[model samples]
Each structure stands twice: as C-alpha cells, then as structure tokens.
Target: MTTVAILDYGMGNLRSVAKAIEHVAPGHEVFVTSDPARVAAAERVVFPGQGAMPDCMRELDARGLRPAVMQAAASKPFLGICIGQQMLFDHSAEGDVPGLGILRGEVVRFPDAAMQGADGLRLKVPHMGWNEVWQRQPHPMWDGIPDGERFYFVHSYFVAPADDDIVAAQTDYGLRFTSAVARANIFAAQFHPEKSAAAGLRLLANFIRWQP
Candidate 1:
C-alpha cells in the first residue's frame, strides 16, 4: 500500500491534516510521524506547520528531522500547508530564520504599507477567514477546483517566490499575494485544506490522484 507521511515535528495541527488526507484518500495510509526513518521512507510527504518560524525551525532541528525533510522535498510528491509552505523558502523575516532553500523565495510578513485596503480599511495581521484564490496557472492539484475557489486561510506571512511562474494561485487580503505555488513534484499553499469545505476536499482528492 502507498504511504503518505505527514511530518510530525511538533508544530501545528498534525492530526487534522492526517484526518483530512485519510478522509480524501482512503486507499493510501497516512502516518503522522516524527521518526526520521518513517519520514525518509514514506512514498509521499505532507509537511504541515503552524506557529513562529524560530520555534518551528528549532523543533525541526532538535528532532533531527531536517535531513529527512530535505530528502523528501527533493524526491517526493510533497504538499506543504500554511507554515509548512513558508519553510520552503530560503529565508523568513518572521524571526530572521533560514528555510530549506528548496524554493527560490523569501517568506515575508505582509507589508505595513500594503496592510490597508485602497478604501483605507486596515486588515488584520493573521489574514484569517475564507478568501477566493485566483488560479494563475493550470496544474494537477488545481484539478476539479475552480478558477477562483475560496479556501480557509489563517496566516500572517506569505511566500514571495523569486520566480513568478511557479505561482499557481493568488489571493487578496489587504493586498494580493501568492496563495499557492507549484513546481516539479511539490504543491504548497498558505491555506488550510483541512479547514476548507468542498473545494478543499476536492484539492486533497486531486493531490491523491496527482502523478507528480
């Protein structure tokens, strides 16, 4: 049986991610694992995270899971959620932390200058709630999901990939930002599919069927 590993390095809602994956892809086994060997051996990888970057990095390093994560990021079908997506970049301003450098961008906080809408309305930092994700390019993970699908998002910072072509979807809170990015064998998003409704489920299903 194919196995998908949800990396468990003590940071975000791990079980929710696991359950969502299990619910959508029942044929595959989902394991919420912290063991390096398990993560290294999984057929596919889901790196999910929440919380501060410094702490997330610290925990990942402490658990000796960084090597495993790097290996998986290079060779497997990987899905990164929320902070998990942020950690793929080369750096993050959240705590002046360095990421895995798998992606060519920097994860940054929403600019204070761009924090307010054109109408002079100030937006919150975490950018919480449901927002429409505008599809920027065609991809397998976006299969069945509409061109402008709304997904549940709760994030303060977002990725700014150096390359624009890799952006799969865009969303606007106070300002437009990359909501999802796809390249090679990876599909990452700043939203929580587990918290999203029908569209989210469909995305998970598409991910299950995704050959990449």
Candidate 2:
C-alpha cells in the first residue's frame, strides 16, 4: 500500500484533506505529520494549507519542514491543495511573501473587480465558494475528472507559472487562471478537492493510484 504523508504545518485544513484521502484509499497509509523524518520516509506527500502565504511559509520554516517538503516533491509524488498549491511557486503577493520555490512563478490577486460579478463586488479579496475547472492538458492527476467540473475554492491569490506546459487545468474568476498544475511527480490544485464532492473524491482516488 502507498504511504502518504500529509504535512502538518499548523495552517491547513489537514484533517479534512486526510479524511478525504483515507476515504478513497483505505488500504493506503495516510499520516498527518510535522516530523521531517516521517515526511522523508513517505512514498507520497500532500501539502494542504489555508490563510496568507507569508504565515504559511513562516510556519513551515518554524517547524523545519520546508526542506523535507521540497525534497519529497523533488523525489516523490507530491500533491498540493489550496494555499499548498500556491506555495509550490516562487512567491505570492497576498502578503508580499516568498514561497517554497518548487515551481516557477508567483501568486497574484484576481484582476478586474467586475469579472468576479456584482455579488462579489466591492470585495477585493478572498475569492470564495465553488468554481468550475477548465482542464487544459491530459494528465494522470486529473484522470477520470471531467472538464468544466466545479470545485470549492476560497482564496484571493492564484498561481501564474512561468511555464505554460505545467498547467493542467484552469478556472475563471476575474480571468482564466491556473487552477491545477503538474510537472513530473509534482501535482497541485488551487481548489480544495476535499470540499468538491464526488469530483473531488475522484481526484484523490486518482492521486492515490497514480504511479510517478
């Protein structure tokens, strides 16, 4: 069975993400850990996070888990969710913060207030709720998932990768932005698959079964 480690940096919805993975891969071992040793030993790693980019970086650094996470992504299958996805990049404008630099590019705020619609009007930050993902490339990470499938999202900033080839899926808020990305053994989603219902489960299942 695959052993998956959920990096616990004290800022993510760790339990929910872990529960979703456990529901899909009952036979696989899923551990929520802050220990670098366990993360290094795991076959796969899931990095889930919420809140500002700077705080997330600080917590990861504080726990001394940043290097371990970077190593895992470089050598094994790594799945990043929400802020976890943003951190894989070079930086984020959310808090004028630097990211883990696993992937090139930076996270920026949604452009054009009107693009988010009138209900979301005046709200310059925190793009929340369910949104559909537009798949761009065929990848194992998104296998069995349909195009234009809606997923839960709750963030103001989004990843803008330097390389377009790594973008596997996109979603439109103010504009079309990178929602899912993949390169080698590393895959990430800006939306919360754990909160996206059946579509989310399918994604988790795919990740569990995916061979690097």
Candidate 3:
C-alpha cells in the first residue's frame, strides 16, 4: 500500500485533514506525523497548515522537519494546503516571513482598500466561505473535479508565483488570485479540500490516485 504522510508541525486542524484523506483514501496507508524520517520515507507527502506564517516557519524549524519536507517536495508526489502552500514559496508578506523557497513565488495579502466585491460590498479579509476556482491548466488533480467548482477558503494572504507558468488555478474575491499552483510532482492549493465537502473529497481522491 502507498504510505501517505501528513506533515504535522503543530499548525492547523491536522486531524481534520488526516481524516479527510483517510475517508477518501481507504486503500492507502495514511498517517499524521511530525517525524522527519517518516515524512521522508512516505510514498506521498501532504503539507497542510493554518496559522501565522512566522509561527508556522518557526515551528517547522523547531521540529526539524524542514529537510524532509524539502526532500519530499522534490522527490515525491507532494501536496500542500492553506498555509502549507504559502510555506513552499520564497516569501510571504504576512509577518514579512520567508518560506521554504521550494517554488519561485511570494505570498501577498489582499489589499484592504480594494476589498469591494462585484456587488460593491466590502469583502472580508480572511476570504472565508466558498468560492469558485477557475482551473488555469489541466492537471491530474483536477480530474473529476469540474472547472469553476467552489472550494472552501480562509486566508488573507495568497501566493503570487514569480513565474505565472506554474499557476494551475485562480479564484476571485476582492481580486483574482492564484488559488492553486502545480509544478512537476508538486501540487499545492490555498483552499481546504477537507472542509470543501464533496468536491473537496473528490480532489483528495484524485490526489490519492494521481501518479503525477
């Protein structure tokens, strides 16, 4: 069986993500882990988190999971969620933090002054609730998931890759933003598939089945 490790660096609802992956990937062995060796040894790795960018990076360094995460991102079919996605980039405007630099990008916050939606209502900072995602490129992760399907989001910051070629999907709130990015064996999303109900589960299922 393929072993899936959900990197736990003491951030976000790790169990919820673990449970969601478990629910969809019954045939695979899924475990929530912080051990670097376990993360490196897994067939696939998932990095999921929600919290302040600086705190997440600090905790990851404290736990010494950095190298393993870097290794997995380079050598395996890797998935990043929420702040997990942000951590892969070179930097984040949140707390002016530096990320793992796995991909060429930066995380930026939604402009406070430009928070007006199409209805002319001021949008919230966290960008919580469901929003439609426009798939920018074809990917195995998008299999069975219709383009423009709504997914759950809860973040003030979003990734802006220096190279637009890596962008896999986009979403609009106060502005159009990169919601998902794909490069080689890695696919990271700013939305929470676990909290996304059916479509989320389907995406998880696709990840489990994806060869990348």
In order of lDDT, best first, we have 3, 2, 1
- The digit string of per-residue lDDT tens for model 3 on 56-131 reads 9999999999999999999999999999999999999999989999999899999877589899999988899999
Question: All candidates' lDDT scores?
Answer: 0.90, 0.91, 0.94
Best by TM-score: 3
* Per-residue alpha-carbon lDDT of candidate 1 for residues 123-169, written as tens digits (9 for 90 to 100): 77778899999999999998888888899999889999999999999
> On residues 1-212, what C-alpha lDDT tens digit does candidate 2 reach at each position?
99999999999998899999999998899999999999999999999999888999999999999899989999998999999999999988888888888899989988645665547655455778988899999898777888999999898889999999999999877678899999999999999999999999999999998888
TM-score of 1: 0.96
Task: Write the number of the candidate with greater lDDT, choosing between 1 and 3.
Answer: 3
Clash totals for all candidate models? 0, 0, 0
Off by over 4 Å in 1: 118-120
How well does each candidate superpose onto the true structure, as a TM-score?
A: 0.96, 0.94, 0.98
